[model samples]
Target: MKDTATPRFRFIDHTSDLGVVLYGKNLEELFQNAALTMLTIMLGDIPELTGEPATINISVSGTDLSDLMVCWLGEILFLSEAEGIAPCTIEIKSVSPTLLEAELRTVSVDPSSIIREIKAVTYHEIKVEKRDDHWEAKVVFDV
Candidate 1:
């Protein structure tokens, strides 16, 4: 078990790739935290969007919890790398064992603020589990 008393997500230092541990009281919050973590990593600064941020819907499906996390974060990465968007906020509207749907509020990225480019979201040491009353996930990115 890891610390769960403070922020919902925290970055983990990795020798090569980027990593984060996400905590949530439910699946919705878990996914939301995951998205935020990825955005924070990509943007370097937490974005505060105002005046007509772009809104988009995202959906992904996977076979299990760990797979779901990868797919979910992968979509977020796609929005950044391919679509030139950095998410300001994520609202996980619905989630189930194998599927997720969310609304993202985003803004165009500032290329210089991107600390490092995330090549992909990897399966390395991915874990999603319930501990006490909340769920936690550990994810590593191929940067």
Candidate 2:
């Protein structure tokens, strides 16, 4: 199958915090792209890494796709904090309106290489919906 285009994420800087706003054609793509953006902030030019791939298994549930997206990214942050891992690739195994399961893979990074650490994923200004058969969502990361 031809690879689908990935989602687009924009960084936003507030007086007190930094975050990203993301848009995608589907829920899976939205979540995957958000993760990529977050990791990019943590490690710049991720395409330059030649390290071995690492994998992460994630499962999350929420009242809606919007909430689910936040929860999904929250798990990734948890992995970074607890396991010292940074994910570069995400693969969705299954997703529903309220639940999602996926695998994430990335190489390790030096603690000093992280310029900014994301504290959490938030529900603020979050949106997830379908437009002309394409799914889309917006999320903000707490940095």
Best lDDT goes to which candidate? 1
Best by TM-score: 1
The CA lDDT at 30 in model 2 is: 70
Q: After superposition, how far is residue 48 of candidate 1 from its true place, in Å?
A: 1.6
Cα deviation in Å at residue 87, candidate 2? 1.7
Per-residue lDDT of model 2, residues 14-96, tens digit only: 66667566665666777777777777776674534356786668788989888888888788777666577777677888889
Candidate 1, residue 97: lDDT: 82
Q: Model-by-model lDDT, in order?
A: 0.85, 0.72
**Pairing residues by index, what is the TM-score of model 1?**
0.89
Q: Write the residue-wise lDDT of candidate 1 on 63-106 in tens digits.
A: 99899999999998887878778788888989998999999898
- Give the Å error, residue 60, model 1: 0.9
